[model samples]
Target: MTDRTPGEPTGLDIALQWAELPPEHLKAALQALEPELARRHEMRMLQARLEAQGAEDRRSHLLYLSGLVGGFLIVVAMLTASVIVGINGLPWLSAMLAGPSVLSLAGLFVLRRVDSGTARQVARAHDAALGAAQPTPGAGVV
Candidate 1:
C-alpha cells in the first residue's frame, strides 16, 4: 500500500482543489471520476432497496406476532372465564365457554401452519425470481 496518511487528498479531492485548471483538463478530471461516481450511485440505490425491504419485513413480522399474541390472550381469557363459571356452579355454561377455547386453539395452530407455509412459498418465489436454484427439501444428504 502507498504511504497515504488519513489527511491525504484523494483523486476527487485533488480534482476539486484544482478550481483554476483549464476547462479541458477539468473535464478530463471529472470524466476520470465518472465510473466511481456511477458505482457509488448504484450502491446507494441497492442499499435503499434493501432497507425498504427490511422495513416491510419487520412490519409484517410485528403484525403477525401481535395477532398471535392477541389470539392467545383471547384463548386464555376464555379459559379463565370457563374456570370461574365452573367454580360458581354453572357446569353447563362453563362447558359452553370452554368449547370455543378448544376451537380457538385449533384455529391458532392452523393459522400458524398456514403462515409458515406462506413464508416458505414467498421465499421460494423470491429465489426463483432471482434465478437461484433451490434444492428440494428432503433430497439432500440423509
Candidate 2:
C-alpha cells in the first residue's frame, strides 16, 4: 500500500479524479451508488417509520397513551356508526360496515399525538411481532 497523508493525491489516484468527466460518467457513478444508496435510504425510511410507530405506554412517551384511549373511543364510534347504519342503507350502511376504517384512522391520529421516542417504540414492538414470536404469558414479558 502506498503511504499517503491527508489532502495529498498520488498520480494514479489523481488521474481517477473526474474533474472533467462527461455526463455519461455520472451514470457510472450513480450506478455504483445505486444499490448502496437505495439500502441506506430504505434503512432511513424504515427508521423514521419505526419512530412514528412507537408505543404510548412508555414513561416519557405518555402521549401515545392518548391514542390507546382514543382507540377505545374509535371502537365505540364504529359500533355506534354501524348500529346507526344498520337501520339505513346505501353509503351509510357501507359506512357502518367500514366504520373500522374510522376506528383505525382514529388510532392513527392518536398515535400521531405521541412523541417520536414512543413512536419508535411502536415500530420496535411491531418489528418484534414479526420475528420468532412466542406466547409470553406473564404479567410483564416480551
Candidates in order: C-alpha RMSD to true structure: 18.5, 21.0
Compared with the true structure, what per-residue lDDT tens digits does model 2 show for residues 1-142?
A: 2234677754445346643587677557657656865776788888777776664236546656766787768777776776676566444454434433553456476655555665566556544543423334694865
Q: lDDT (0-100) at residue 23 of candidate 1?
A: 81
Instruction: Give the lDDT of residue 29 in candidate 1.
Output: 78
For model 1, the superposed segments whose C-alpha errors exceed 4 Å read 1-12, 101-142
lDDT: worst 10-residue window of model 1 = 126-135
Per-residue error (Å), model 2, residue 132:
38
The TM-score obtained by model 1 is: 0.53
Residue 51 error, candidate 2, Å:
23
